[model samples]
Target: MNALEKLKILGESAKYDLCNYVSPNLETYASGKIPGVYNSTSPDGHCMPLFKVLMTNKCSNDCKYCMNHSNRKFERYEYEPAELSRVFMDYYNKRYVEGLFLSSGVFKDIDSSMEKQVEVARILRDYGYDGYIHLKILPGTSYDLIKRAMSLADRVSVNIEAATPDGFEELTTTKNFKTDILKRMKWISRLSNDKNMAPSGQTTQFIVGAADESDEDILKRTNWLLDKFKIKRSYFSAFTPLENTPLENYESPHPKRTSRLYQADFLLSYYGFSFDELVFDENGNIETEVDPKYSFAMNNMDLFPVEVNEASYDELIRVPGIGMVSAERIITLRKRGLKIGKLEDLKNLGVAVKRAEPFVKLNKSYQSVLSF
Candidate 1:
């Protein structure tokens, strides 16, 4: 196939990985200067169309839910290192994209597949192209290659795919959850620190609801990864059954469930939430219809209504709609002896006072706005 045809097939094939790392372009987003989707920042800072493609779709592993798994019958394509570099440059030079997100299916072994990806990156850098490049570290790739890949790429990642070992085995027989995937994550974490490379740091993805994994299970693993390995980011790709794949007959996971997962992740990472606070149903599932932050607040009612004028910064973030910025504003105003006079004052200061109403106490007496 020609380069365009290969790009079409490979790009379509790549749409499933569901890993997102692009920083938002807030300035022109409302006016529509940037593309709505697939736009991200390079490790070096340009924010626009990120050229995301897989090196190859051929695979050695049979991930049951995956469209490109080994046993799945489908036409495949491969991009030689030189061909990929030229194609990427064609797009880059024309200003079609500002960064590259390169990933691949493991065709032979980890090192070989990873090497092809590395060469694409090396070729880009060698051509004096210094935009952002995000590369995926295949399972079982060597430490030396890991170090090398990090050196040439702006950001690198090894997808945990499944949070736990046994859960991972249910999806693919070819990969050992710890031996192949987790071990590589450990290597990247160590190498990233020692070399000070991939300044955007490392990230991982979880295939949510695949292998019957619970939302709670995903959160626990995410917490552990953040605490133990310091993974820069974790992405969730809610399972969507593909035609002809082993899981084709299964139900696709809810998109709102995936959204709720992001909210829960934010609460834990930024809002100082613990697993104990996020109420899970009997089946270990988080509530799909509600935002996890609001749900967590509902469960811990006594903690609220937070006295906005008196609550600490940590306490304010836990209140449903009071974000970091508004919390800081409230704190600064309070430090200046500016008492938050009314709901309008809170709103003027940028608090989402509507959501915060039930959770925050009025500056006056024990009665809160929620009481009204």
Candidate 2:
């Protein structure tokens, strides 16, 4: 097949893996703007840029949720080590991309497949290609192979597709539970902490709505991963059923629910909210109408109207709309001794006080009462 045809077949087959990383534009940076200073039409639109790409779509495992599994009758293709390196370099040379994100479907056994991935990365590095490279470290691979892969790639990931042991067994039938996946994550975590290791760090993806797992179960596992492994990020892919797969008839998760889980993950990482606080009931599913922060404020009415000047950082973060940035601003601005008589004062400093008022006290007065 031609290059275009090969790309079509490869990209189509790889889409079922559900890994996504979007690149950012550097228009503001070109003008010599300082880092962390973002220019956006709206205040909330500021974020750093990234670049992402898939590596290959060949596999030996029969993951039920994956379209490129060995049992599935789909067109298969594998980019040779040199060909993959050339493609990435071509993109980089033309300034069409910023980095390479390489993942595969286990074309051979874990060791051989991982070796091939490392070979591609080695070629790029030897050619002096300096850009971000995120590689997927397959489960059951040797510790030595993982170490080698980590040495060349900037970021590494191992997906734990299911939340529970039974859920993992149901999805990927042949893999061992804790021994194969969790053990590798533990090793990666250890390696990342070492000062000489790659600086970008490690991340993982969990397939939501593929099996019978509540949001609470997923968040609980995420908390465990973060505490135990010091993971940089945990990605949640809303499970999309593929044709001819065993789970083709399964119901997919609502997109809004997936978005809320990401929001909840942020709350857990930065705002000190527990998985239990984000959930409405014992099952741990977030309310669909509002995000978890708003839900938390509405439920804990007793904590509202906290004094902005005197409230501690922990207390300020619990408020419905106040994020880490706004909380710091509130603390810093209060020290200036400005006469903050009303909620509108926060608007000048770019704080969303409309959402904060119900949960904050201004100048020792509870200006707004919680409705629920």
Candidate 3:
């Protein structure tokens, strides 16, 4: 196929990887955004637009939840390293993209597939193109190959793909939960930020809902991964069943599960929240109707109305709508002898006052204003 034809097929195939996406609500961004224009935050916290696509969609593994799994029937496509590199350079030169996110469905073997992806990063660098690149490390790839890819890339990931090994075992026949995936994660952690290695560190994704795992199940693993590996971040992809896959008849998960997971992940990674403090319903899942922060605030009603002038950084962030930046701003302003006895003053400091009103004591009369 020609470049245009390859772009059409390969581009559609790669949408399943939501590594660059923080939210699935693209309808809100659909009108303003165009193809290959994805806003992904980098390791240093700069949100950069990426040119995301797959090296190939041809796979040998039949993960039941994957759209591009081997059992699925479709027009398979692969991009030669040179062809993809040239295409990416064209886009980069035109300023159509700021960086690249390259992933692939495992084809012949883990080594060959990973080499192909690393070659793309290598080729771009050979062309004197220095831009941000995030490469996906195939499960079971060797450390030598990983080291080579890490040298050329800013960040790399090995997709955990499921919440737990046993849960993943039920979803796929070929993958070994203990050896193939986790061992590779350990290798990445061992080599992170080493000489000529990926300075940004490692990240992994877990497919939600596909393995019949709850948000709590995902959170526990997320917390452990964060605390143990000191990994950069986690990405969540809600299980969307595709036709021709084994799970085609399975119901598509709500976006709220993805959204709530992101909220809880931030609370775990950034704000100081424990798994016990998460407000899960009887089903052992987070409440999809409310943001996890709001749910936590409701569950801890006795802790509400925290005095804005006195609440610590952690305490301020625990409230419904106050973010870390805003919380810090409140503290900075208070230290400047700014008495924040009113809602307007807090709002001026960047707090989402409406969301914070019920949870904070702006003043004794502030809570009564909304009767909230």
- Candidate number with greatest lDDT: 3
Model 3 lDDT at residue 134: 89
lDDT of 1 by residue, 1-372 (tens): 887778877776666554444322121221123221255544355556767788999989888888888988889889999998998898888887777888899887878999999999888899999878889888888999989999988789888888788789888888888878888888888877855578778888888877878888889999999988888888888788888888888887776777787788878887888878887889888888778888888888878787887899999989888888899998998889879768888889888777888887766444454533
Residue 285 lDDT in candidate 2: 82
Tell me model 1's lDDT, rounded to 2 decimals. 0.80
lDDT by residue (109-173, candidate 3, tens digit) is 98999999999999999999987888988888898998888899988888887888778986899
Candidate 1 least-lDDT 10 residues: 23-32
TM-score of 1: 0.92
The segments of candidate 1 whose C-alpha lies over 4 angstroms from its true place after superposition are 19-37, 41-47, 365-372
Q: Return the TM-score for each candidate structure.
A: 0.92, 0.88, 0.93
Number of backbone collisions per candidate: 1, 8, 0
> Which of the two, 1 or 2, has more lDDT?
1
Pairs with steric clashes in candidate 2: 23-50, 24-49, 24-50, 305-359, 305-360, 305-361, 306-360, 306-361
Cα lDDT of model 2 by residue, 1-372, tens digit: 654345555544443333333211112321222211122221245332222334556688878888776788877777777876776676567655566666776865888888888898899899998767778888888999888888888888888888899889889876876988999998888888775465677888888899788888888888999999987778787788989888999988876877777778888987888766775566668776788888887777777767777888889888777778877888887788764677787666566877776676677877676632
